[model samples]
Target: MTSPSDGTLVAEPRTDAWEFGDFAYGLEPLTMPPVGDATVSSALVPSALPPCNPDLVLFRLRLLAEGGTPDLPDTFTDPTDDQLFWFRWITGHQISFLIWHLMGEILERNTDREIPDRASLARLETYAYGYCAMLLYTGSCPIDLYQSLIRPRMYLQHRSFSGTWASDFVPVRGLFRGRGVARGDAPEAAGLARAVDVHKTIHDGIAARLVPEGRSLLQQTMKETVVRPSERTAILYDNFFMTLRAPVDGEGITSQLLRRLDAVASDVAARGLYPLGYGGDERPKELRSAEVAHCENRIGHLLHEVGEAAATPAKPLS
Candidate 1:
């Protein structure tokens, strides 16, 4: 593994990494809808959206399924140091992906139920808006294990553990009973299963009260009942509803937001993290680091951009 400045590590990309190339390509020219002064009497009622807006949820799931195997630039690895930078980078990316997935569950529920009340929308918006901020933060800082570990501690000390979004999803170990993909599982099937488990556990817990319908939309998505995975991706692309709201008095908004974002970011990073030079590529150390960082940056930027865009209502594509 190559260590870089600020204790960051970079990993080499593999051939399979290109699986995400098309999705990545689709994400180019990403832009957020302007959060203008147009205030709806109620936060409900579907704000005007753009045609074919990017879906953070589906994009995130696809990213997670793909993992971080892409060929990264070489500048991120520093051999002279014993730091675990690459591990941290991957950990952060994974967390970002998970966070986006959870948020998707929230949006799906809100839209399907036609949550028409402004207060409800406000709560959802609170989460949605913070998600955007998180994306920006991740894109710019790119959390590592070090940051991940530290942030959680800090958040727990000051914030209320209840009412957080991820509090809904169950942990991966608890959800998946058998290891290795089933006979019919696809190449990415195992990873997708793990992702679904995570999504189901978390969303089921977090929005339990709000979505009183029982069984999260995430579960439905998995069953291919309400929406197919690919169709969910399109829905994610079309729906941009900010769930993060401004902190109210006595509300630990900052701490809550940070904790939730950090959790997902950390999880995703862990999933994608790989050791540098593990593949036996003869590429120069510095070049390899740069390549990894490039991929990390791409993932990070997409997370941030998607969050920003999701803050606004997505219009139907003509």
Candidate 2:
């Protein structure tokens, strides 16, 4: 491993983990395991990543965390309201990307089509709720900015761009969308079902609020029909979020998750998503409702199990 002369951490693309297939399992992270059998001394862990490194701006938080620094950006220490609004959009999407990716790994059918264990199902339920929380911050992006910058770009990229197009999302869509329930009437499955209900409502609410015009995305674009490129949409979605279909390891993502959760939890606790009169003045009227507020509270502050795990540094022991 080549070290940076100034000690800045350099991120590279990983081969073992893909954008959709690799999920970081712990809201409360488990112990970090070695990458392989041989383990000998170095605070810096080695990951055998290839040349086309996927760790872009979107993955900086996770990379920073893995390097043992505070998992958040330095400016986050005392952010202004304007800073909060802009950064929240970036961080919120990043968080949602991770949560969705993790959810995909949990719900994807195994080679033998085995059902996920009760714990994974339970985690699915929990993260379903967490994904909703992520919306509060993301949706908090000023309406003008969303319209002028985000939404227009989305349409320009692909009129039919949707979550259904996401590579990882395809595998887990059925479970969350009510088509596949692994355990018929079991409590674990039931919990996930219930969370799915809440998830849909929150998701739709944010989308509706953001796009009051109510225009539907195109069913299929001309290019899509002509090419029928299976992974095109998936690649587009991944690129939009600055994620890559690369290799990753369990211990790597898990430890990074704990650090990320801690960082998000700190931000949420220090000041609610919108800091009233401080940095943030107010939320849009549509998003200021009780329902939206509830989701905001749930994201970082109210997630008991997930929040607790973030309090400690979850680094791999040498």
Candidate 3:
């Protein structure tokens, strides 16, 4: 890939694995076959099992990727102000913002437009479905769920006056056009719809695991927020490209981000799982950790692909 650096175009070689789809099932959880000698199933090891069903992973991932406020389960007990805040933070704005940032970055790289600063690229809209599909199919980041404001949420700040700012969203109705989706639909339109579906599933799954009060609280919150029907895709392709402006070490920025994300996920599982208690059925903890890790891996993999593609130099004709 090529990019201008001090008036010189720098190029990097591309890898066979440097594609968004390459990471779709990159880090699936392993299910071990029972072993006779060790009594420990190989399933416990992530690498032991074959890759997960790409279709199902993609399905569950759709839920995890596009999280929102309405996805929460019903509330059983009243939430403390702090708990409510965290719940909101986890289920909505922050996660949506991060996904937008990633999608924007991809669009910017492909179109040579500054995505963060502009709105609605007529040119990129044609490829919107394909791009949106790839992002939904490949984008995942568990760490983003726990945090608020991944990229300052400023990209769409100016567009807030336009139709409720990411509300009233309707999913692509079906695989065919007029089913809530058409060939010309904006990327974010289809993107947000899938996000809502996935978010709802996640809340339901979590609520089922928690105690009665916990489940009730989640359910209550879930019902409180209602998404209005959206007229068009809320955020559109822009020309402004985003930059971290942070110093890059020996490894590239993508590598650094992945490393940091890995650490964050590890720390979360290490501290978060303690409540489950030692020897208190590690399966749930392991499964949760693996799932979170999978999401982190998908994000890291996509970023690496985007970074490389952005830097790819034009090849000379033979």
Candidate 4:
């Protein structure tokens, strides 16, 4: 994880990690030609449409096409820390992880209409490993218990919560369920149904929105609780999007962007938070504390270059 004083990342050859070069040209194309209803054989003529925001139409099309083969970020070279964080965050929010979890749940419950994509079934195990790593990093409850408590709670939250994107999909979901009624004959109805499934799959796999116990512990512990002599509390604000907008370089922005997480983890430990029975500890109390300490150390070492890297976008690769 150590980098030169100039803040240039060592750029270790990684067999298991994704390099920046891999995704250099992988962004989904933004422009989409006018599309007709899924059932319509003909494409819609753009000019024939009434005056409306063409930008919005393009945006929706782009959003639908955003899902590509998921891969780790280029900066994920160090296994000790970067991979841990990447794995944790991906399983918690990534679409790949969500769909996989939902399919597994449906199979386990032996629900009807359980159409399994045997080809993609392996992704479930991959995400499960990441999910387990996330639990360990966040010091959350045991995997099974966390799933039991979190899934149903999140399912309800997805329906009722208005602030999140999940809530916006509720109408579409209802439309899907009632497709046999008014829209049954529409050509696009099947596409709408698939969209509904994708929407629910993502909502069901959210690990960030935990059960009451997990949420309470995380919220309380993540606050600026550890007041330093300088009166600074350990708080790691999410600057990910902003950091993304900023220029990136070969030196790697993660070295500076996520540096605060170390302090946050330290603060959580210093406040004696490890032994709390929030999600139920599978390991002995001592081992749990040790793991927390280890997680924090790994986070600290992750992308730990000697110099500070400015938030900047990288130039196009030659």
Query: Which predicted model would earn the best TM-score?
Result: 2
TM-score of each: 0.23, 0.61, 0.25, 0.23
lDDT of 1 at 242: 22
RMSD of each: 18.9, 10.9, 19.7, 19.4
Writing each residue's lDDT as its tens digit, candidate 1 over 128-176 gives 3333323323323222332465334423432221211231122222223
The per-model lDDT (C-alpha) reads 0.32, 0.51, 0.28, 0.28
Instruction: Give residue 64's error in model 3 in angstroms.
Output: 21
* 34-83 per-residue lDDT for model 2 (tens digits): 21221222344443332332233124333332332333333233644555
Deviation in Å, model 4, residue 269 alpha carbon: 34
Lowest lDDT 10-mer window, candidate 3? 236-245
The candidate that achieves the highest lDDT relative to the unseen native structure: 2
TM-score, candidate 3, is 0.25
Over the full model, what C-alpha lDDT does candidate 1 score relative to the true structure?
0.32
What are the runs in model 2 whose C-alpha is more than 4 Å off? 1-83, 109-117, 156-160, 182-185, 216-229, 275-293, 302-304, 307-318
Give one digit per residue, the lDDT tens place, for model 3 in 59-154.
323333333111221322343433333333322232232333334433434444323112233222222322222222222223232123321232
